[model samples]
Target: MKQKKSSQSIRWIIEVFLFIVAIVIFFGGLNHFWMRPVNSDLSKGNSQSRLTQKKFNYVAIGDSLTEGVGDRTAQGGFVPLLAHNIDDSYDVQVKSQNFGVSGNTSTQIYKRVTTDNKIQEAIKKADLITITVGGNDVMKVIRTQLANLSEKSFQAPAKAYQKQITDLFDYIRQYNPNVKVYVVGIYNPFYLNFPDIKQMQDVIDNWNNATKATVDKQKKMYFVPINDLLYQGLDGNEGVTEKTETSHTITNNALFEEDHFHPNNIGYQVMSDAITKAYKEHVNEK
Candidate 1:
């Protein structure tokens, strides 16, 4: 009986040891198959040596969006915000040159690139550049044809816009052979005021497509679409509101209440986020 008892005790100890070994093996396989790939992908996505550089220089040239027209803070809209984001995320010192002008059309911007010596110098030294054009170009066409507007009215202008954009890209490349360019797409801020005008959104979509097509032709150019980002105002966040005890009153409502044409503070934040994400993804894809 004593021998039989001792034999059973040894058997129990071996079974316990094997159970622990099985658990360890199962977890080891899980980590090998799952954890390693995740880590590898994160590293691969931003493995570019330049991205890891300690000092980053960002240059922004475009229209009011880059100028921060509607931003109450007067901090140069998405330009400063984007610089701040890059500073924190990449662990680098970002020196940004913002040359955003209000109500400047694509042609005007093209002209700036062609003539402005300061802008040219900035572009040459820039590690990264962001552009906010094509918005005023689209708006100009709309205002001209509003009396007899139709979807077809945009067709002719969009072609010209495309060429102008192509030229813009080519000129930038002329200055800097390797710096990446991010061109922001235009959105319809008038959608809320004129929801009945279904064709307006269509026109915006067409313009955005044209802008994206232009982006695709260049070597390292990327398009950041913020058309849907501002649409969230449709829910409860529409614009600035004044809450009253007696009445739920909306005194002023806009991503840009000052003009209802440009983006407000929140609007700029969304734009910066989108730009950052696009920048990261574009770099990764190349």
Candidate 2:
């Protein structure tokens, strides 16, 4: 009877152990797939403004490029680089706050601006705002219509992007009425690599044109073009290929990082330059 009882207790322990394992797996999967926290990590830098008492606050907002994803240096991508370039060139005390979250679409950024307290606070105090979005919005359409390509593939997404982008600009203006808003245009990551997928370039350009139109109607908002700088001359329909760095040359897509989705360090630097130049031009106009 004692031996029988011992066996039953062992079975109960095994069952309890399995139950705990199941619970762990359940919650783990839940968090992994669904429960991602929606907050941008706020990082503040550059104290030269403190010493000089100038106090120029620059806030960068948007997706992974704004978060500095492909920058191997991990220096928070083009946001910080733009800040440093502006301060160094202009000789002004600038404080840069990066509120960029990777994989965030235009709608997500609009939500962050309206909902996230930290991001809202930064925007409130920002002297300038640089936004890089609409890339993921375009990507969503591409992914859903991978096997099928058409002229109408991006029409819906582009319209959705226009609304979200308009709301984003409105939110920024609501928070910081006087600050300069620079909207970065999306580049075609697949342009040089997937020449056959000619629809992507048109999709990107259409989205960018929509974005430019939105920004043009708003006061203190400027659209910065980075698409032309990233992979120029690919024209989508051109059945052309260029030699890549690798001996196994595939296509002329030399601007993208190893992921072939995001920009490389060079690409990000070019982005920084473009934004900085725009900012300088804006400053001169002011």
| Per-model CA lDDT versus the true structure | 0.72, 0.70
Q: Residue 22 lDDT in model 1? A: 47
Q: Report the Cα lDDT for candidate 1.
A: 0.72
Q: How many residue pairs collide in each prediction?
A: 2, 1
lDDT of 2: 0.70
- Predicted structure 1: clash tally: 2
lDDT of 2 by residue, 5-33 (tens): 56654554344344335434533443222
Q: Residue 46 CA error for candidate 1 (Å)?
A: 26
Q: For model 1, how does the per-residue alpha-carbon lDDT over 1-286 read when each residue is reduced to its tens digit?
A: 9899566545533443443354345434432211110000012234486477576778888887887777777667788888887777876767787877766799999998899898898889888899998877876775576445567878999999899889889999999989989988888765443333456688898899878987988998888998877765535454445557764433223366534566788788888999999887766554
Number of the predicted model whose lDDT against the real structure is largest: 1
**Residue pairs in candidate 1 whose N, alpha carbon or C atoms collide under 3 angstroms:** 239-254, 255-264
